[model samples]
Target chain A: MKELTILSGKGGAGKTSVAASIASVAQNAVLCDDDVDAADLHLIFKPEVKEVHRFEGGQVAVIDEEKCTNCGICWSYCRFDAIHTKAGSGFYINAYQCEGCRLCERVCPSKAIHSYRNNNNYWFVSDSRFGPFVHAKMGAGEDNSGKLVATVRQKAREIATETNAEFIINDGPPGIGCPAISSISGVDAVLLVVEPTRSGLHDAQRLVSLTNSFNVPVYGFINKYDINLQVSETIEAFLNKNHIPLLGRWNFDVNIVKAMLEKMSVVEFAPEGETAREVKKVWEQLKSLMLTD
Target chain B: MKTLITSTTSTPEGPFDKRFGRAAWFCVLDEKTGESTFIKNENAEGQSGIGTKTAEKVVELGVGKVISGDFGPKAKKLLDKFGVQMVIINEDLKVIDIINRIKG
Candidate 1:
């Protein structure tokens, strides 16, 4: 199956909206939201969760007060300063500052320290209107979002392969950080959702170079291209210089937000609308490119 | 007793590496003989877990003490488990300088 990720280096670049609409057109595709930190695609798909799996991001050390010996070995050895003393309770581990390395647990001479896994993160397999969907939720200030992205993508791939689906489309996270890298890695192609703003072009440039480094073929569409005609021209010029294919130039429409409020993808929300037609064309272009191989 | 010092190069005169896990080389010094040997860190440029991997290697090398600019939390934990002493020296000294000072 062909795997494609929708990415924009900058946030609010319409990655989720564009990806979700494209999923409606790519009817045989398995869809996944790789942005675990602040996932939004589920709002459009309205998935019914089939499986829920907890993710242990890392281990946090805990001190047992019953052991009674106020030994300071754990306190001294804690590189993260996670171990702190309370007035009557003695030492306690600060879950926030804890790096979850379990150093203090190993160093405690009295064996008062033990480690526990942080299970605040979870991934899900679900049935959406678009097909099997995989997504995740990360706890606030949780570590290992990158690993969680991998897990979500893995589940999506397994489901796609099992169902013999034609495509695996991911709504990727913003920026060139860990989660973004995890989202794009080993994917057959990347669909860049570029917004026509100076900052949008700037961030898309970074994302473009990153895709280049990963050697992933990139196809793009300018979301809200009419919002800034001059910047759109510049962005188009840049994409042309880099030899990245431009599939469609879309207009800025309030219908996107209206479609979300109605809990529908653009294609489903407005079947005969201009945006839906363009998105369908985008999907057709993407399918020809990915299926050509 | 043997002590390990993180270094930027595989030479006694090379600048000491401030970072522990990403150091280019580690200089192992035999305190009794005042002899030092350099071992390149193969996992220096690796992504994630290199600190713990390097710590495991140091424990396998059977060093009594380790000196570096800083230690990652995971590395510090693993080394402490094996009773490997960690010494953080923030000074910009050469590997030979650390060896002489520690030997003395």
Candidate 2:
């Protein structure tokens, strides 16, 4: 099966909206939202969760005050200051500050520090109108996002093989961090969503270089290309210089916002509009490219 | 009193007079000769606020005391296990300079 991942260099670049649009047009596709951090595709897909699984990122150290020795040993050894004495009584690990290394628990002479796996993350396999979607929800301020992304991808692959889907369209997270890196690996192609702004170009370049490192074929779609025509031209030129395909360019339209409010992809919300048509052409090209391979 | 500067690398002589995590770096300077082995850190990278396996390494290196920008719970426990005294500093300062300031 061919995998088409939609990615942006930074947030608010309309990656999800475009991915949702592609899913609407693509048939027999397994959709996965690899944006484990700040995932919002569910808001649009309105998926009904079929299965839920817990994600264990790591362990957090907890201090038991009842053990009675406030010797300050943990206070002096802690690198993260996760352990602190509360007004001269006992120590505690600030969950936010704790990295869950469990060193304190091992070193505690009084056996006061207890390290345990923190179940702050969860992943879901859901049934959406487009197809079966693999997505996840990370607790606020929780880490281990890279692992979660891998889980989502694995589930998507499983479901796709089970259903004999021809494609897997992934909505990837922004930046060159762990989740983004996970999304780009072993994928058939990547659809980079670019916005026409100074920072947009800068971030797009970073994402392109990262994708280049993987030797993956990449295509670009300039979202809101009309906002800054000069920048849009620069983006097109950069794509040419780098030999990355420019799928299509979209104009600034409030109908996208309206479509989102109505819980529909832009293509489905405004089937005949210019923005929808551009997205459709891009989808068709991507589908053909996948078929050719 | 021997002071150990540490990094996350499981090796000695790692570069960087200070590390990125663990409150920037530590500076434990001597008051007498002013001669100090600057223990710069190159690989002290990991999750924050857990424990300090690296800090345990610092204590094992014969550091009598630690003067650092910050100390996490796990590192602090190991330091205590080895009877290492630590003076936590609030400001981010030069390692050697901060050690000198503490000595004074």
- In terms of TM-score, which candidate is strongest? 2
Best by DockQ: 1
lDDT by residue (A125-239, candidate 1, tens digit) is 9998889999888788875455566667767866876898878999998778666766765576789989999999999899887777554679878989899999999999999
Q: List the residue pairs that clash in candidate 1.
A: none
DockQ, structure candidate 2: 0.01
Position A161, candidate 2: lDDT: 68
TM-score of candidate 1 on Cα atoms, chains taken together: 0.70
Off by over 4 Å in 1: A68-81, B1-104
All candidates: DockQ? 0.02, 0.01
| Fnat for every candidate | 0.00, 0.00
lDDT of 1 by residue, B1-104 (tens): 99999987899988787657667799999988888899999876543566788899999999999998656556777999999998876455789998889867
Give all TM-scores, in the order shown.
0.70, 0.72
**What does the lDDT read for residue A151 in candidate 1?**
69
Question: In candidate 2, what are the lDDT values of residues A1-293, reduced to their tens digit?
Answer: 77888999788888888888888988899999988778889988999999999887767888887884988787788899787778756767798899876788777899988887778788999999999988888788876454566568767977886898999999998788666766765577889899999999998999887777554679989999999999999999998898899998889999899999999999889999998888879989998986775
